[model samples]
Target: MMITMKQNSRAPNAITSLDVYLNSLKVGVIVRTPGDFSAFSLNESYRQTGGHPVLSLSLRAASGGLRKDPKPVSKTVPAFFANLLPEDKLREAMEKHHAEAVRPGNDFDLLAALGADLPGAIRVVPSEGSLAVQPVREEGKGKARFSLAGVQMKLSVMKNTGKGGGLTLPLDDNDGQYIAKFPSTAFPGVSENEFANLALAEAISMEVPERELVEKSDFAGIPEDFDTMSDGKVLLIRRFDRDEGHSRIHIEDMAQVFGIYPARKYDGAAYHDIASALNVAISPSAALEFVRRLTLAVITGNGDMHLKNWSLIYRGDGNTPALSPVYDLLSTVPYIPADGMALSLGGERSFKALTADRWKAFAHRARMPEPAVLRAVTDTVALVNENWWQLPERAHVPDRVLDRIDAHIKTLTPILTSCANS
Candidate 1:
């Protein structure tokens, strides 16, 4: 069902409609109708070329036939587009700085303001008969041009500076290659804790992105207000979705792939669901990696591996997607004493309650071989026990933070020990 757009003279200059492009190919159009309702329809040309739907299963023909149609997605903001927008306080700041007066349904305005250098290969620009794409800003040096999603207050930056040393903010529409995460004002020493946890994951042979500790003094372009509160140290996480040339690689989180809203990220989803989705949408090996990461999370006291935390990356090919590198991993138990697992595993959320039998059941539900599942879990336990102790020092985590995490890890030692012996 191809719907060709006829030019409307009443279109607003603030982007009442947008043309969605995936890597230079026009995939669809997002339009805001009367009563502030919004809808996205896939272009007929994209469907004819056998291109993958931007929203996957959520935006497909209802008849289950070979002919694809442009369906009006129920979500006012598509999952793929929603995932790119900032969340919580960051979103509030963005709204205030850009278009504070825009109504709730005017997501196109927000996209037009911050869509230039977003994650993945998706680009949203104004459609014909609507406003033209916003002009590029000529801001002062050190001003950030790009925006990052999620609730955390972080900055996208380029770590490589030739003769001039220090971090460079992605100003002037520069696509950054690294994410510089600062210590949270509420959670002290979070940067060190995450660095330590990520180091431990890498030590256990997990496929993690390259990361390092960056001192504030060594970095330029840090906002003065942030510099005042920060501990002069930040975790520099390499962007797994970007190549060496800083080009965008397609990646979608579990929420996007499953068509679940970000609010329900922790609820209505389980580990088995993630595994099953990976097995169907990607490969069995990707599902196995999910299990390995889950095992690591349990041993490391990480209680925040929610749907948004896990992602699948497309490797230049249009047909296949693989599990992306592990990210947003850290021990939340130390900061929040009552924190629990974000999603259930084998119908259980408590790490201490996860037994071998439950893991086998989870494997069965995920359609994985039971024996291979057990081996992965047991081997991960052994690996963590062998390498976890040396990571805090190597990562330069503070003594107090290390002590808290160590205490929590000790509580789970019995469980790990039992699994290993079993």
Candidate 2:
């Protein structure tokens, strides 16, 4: 089952082109050089129809123009393209299952493996005259091609047959509408932890996707390790990037927009950097939303809000995109006490050291109104203080975990209150 580089009939080493589809429409083509460098060009018809640009500001311009590159715009492959592939444990699973070794930084192989069902409306397929991109399919299903980027041990699965039913794993199918995250063996009840965290965010009136905690019995034929405990529960997060009809909607992460690799998601950047990028790539509302989410992350003890965790969803009206609904919201402090904030906030990774002055400085750097920034922080802190405890109570989080989080929240309350009062 070894997968070798596909050769085109025209030339052995001829450039390989993959048709990039936005839902059913072919919007562009990503070309791969003999040296394995990838570059994208918008389709002429899509350009004429004034379709939205696929890549973000760093690789593609607002006017539907790709960055000028004597070589490819990106040295290996575009960060946007690279960010779509599976990473860490999931990647190892993909390679083992497909029997194809994904080369380091080789986006071509990664896309060929799971290009059919990506995060957004964009789908990559081999163009005519290029080597055909074949996906490993199940017997009755067309192609079971899907990949979710991240280090987390999770799987994409279809929703329950009816309301209040259980979710089914789509291991042999590609039409999944939800992402199921298992409880980590290393951290007991992590599924419940994330569910409660997301529920808390929703209670605070934050834009978060619908989620549920389903019992392991709901799913059939899943691996034993996936259901770590005898009574383990799975957190099912509905895909927000999909439309009402379950069609793919375009979305890109902050790492892709900032032209940074996923490996460097937590390094060499700060909250202000993402806010500034949002201002330039999206609208004022989106930038403001970014500020609010950042505040929420700080107070909720979510130290894993890295670049890949924040994303922009394309509205299909043009190049303009909006901030996506919050996903992967969880308190990491309880599990890893030594863990700091994923990205520095106002040049401070320590949650305790964050002050009003630092927030104002971040606002200045992001070109946002200072008063509005302060209000967002104050509002978020107030909401968390008022309703945070209700989340654990409602979700029935373990008493031990609840006590630890409550203690952590207490320490954070005075700091946030002082910042708001200032």
Candidate 3:
């Protein structure tokens, strides 16, 4: 079934609206309505435009044109649009910082303010007024054109841009190349944990972006208040959505693909669904990549690999899609010992779900080629076995956390049972 939205038939009047553009092509208009999310309508020209990248999998029809479902988002905007804005304290911080231009707790206003530099190649500017210029909180300091999702304390900064230039705040003209993640007081050593996880993922031949941990002292141009929020060291991950020339490369997550809101990201979807969609819309290789990445999450005890965590990248071409470079790799069992997988697979969400029986069942249920799926799992497990202990990034991981990861890995290695026979 195609993903569909129901729009309210309210009398058109003086309501605020935002122009949604993907790579300079006007895709649609979202009008603020008395609903959970604003109402949206696809632009007719965009519908006629050939070679435009798929905005969201939910919006496309089987005939290769925009679905004429008529209305979009009766209670809320499309999940794809909603996912563009930040969430939790980070979103609150953005609203607080831009309170001068927009209403508090208003997502529509927040999108208008932060839309210029959101994730992916999309831009949501006010159809009526000029795009909001970031208000300088500190005298003579450039405010970062900042708008990244997630609850982490992250600052978008341009790292080593010009001759002898170090870390600096990114502007509209000069967008950030890397996301500088700071230490979380609630989740201590998160940067270290991710660093170690990335290194381990690389060992298994996963495609991850360039990443490193940097001292807070090396950071420059961070807003005065944000600098205070940081601890000693930070993790910097290069953005994959932007190219060398800093143009936009489109991206979308499973939540958008499933046509569900972000709040329900962990629910109403599963790893099986993601793999199935990738195989159908993209290629078998992309589905295989998903298998390996989820295996990375499973062995590492990463319980936070929710729908939004997995994504698809479009390299400016409209139809072709691939799994984006791996990111947000965290070892969460140290913080929450009883945690489990974010999405269910083969009727299981626990660490013990990686059984040989479950792997075969998962492939059969997802309609994927069983042999290839099993190989992806066995390859991931084998690579982790061969290279995990000696990972150089282990130096960043604490001994306690490292021990926990090792313990988790041991539990999953036994899934190599039928793997050898496969």
lDDT for each candidate structure: 0.71, 0.71, 0.76
* lDDT tens digits by residue: candidate 3, 1-422: 21122332111122367778887777888877655447778888777874367788887777866676335455445677778767777776666666555566566667766677888888776675444554334555544456787777787788775777678767644578788888877777789999989888877788888998888878765655465464656898989988888888888888877777778878868788889999988888888889888888888799999998988888857466788888899989988988989888777888875677777778987889888888888878888888988888888877787788788888768764356576
Please, what are the lDDT tens digits per residue for candidate 1 over residues 176-288? 88888877777778888888888888888788899988777767765542344646578899998789886678777888776776667889589999998888767788788
Best by lDDT: 3
Q: Give the TM-score ranking, best first.
A: 3, 1, 2
Of 2 and 3, the candidate ahead on lDDT is: 3
Error of 2 at 401 (Å): 2.1
For model 3, state the Cα shift of residue 207 in Å: 1.1
- Candidate 1, run of 10 with poorest lDDT: 129-138
TM-score of each candidate structure, all chains considered together: 0.86, 0.86, 0.89
C-alpha RMSD in Å of predicted model 2 compared with the true structure: 4.8
Candidate 2, overall lDDT?
Answer: 0.71
Error of 3 at 352 (Å): 1.8
Q: List the residue pairs that clash in candidate 3.
A: 37-76, 37-77
What is candidate 3's CA lDDT for residue 148?
83
What are the per-model C-alpha RMSD values against the true structure? 4.5, 4.8, 5.6
RMSD (CA, angstroms), candidate 1: 4.5
Instruction: Using TM-score as the measure, name the better of candidate 1 and candidate 3.
Output: 3
With a 3 Å backbone cut-off (N, CA, C), the pairs that clash in candidate 2 are none
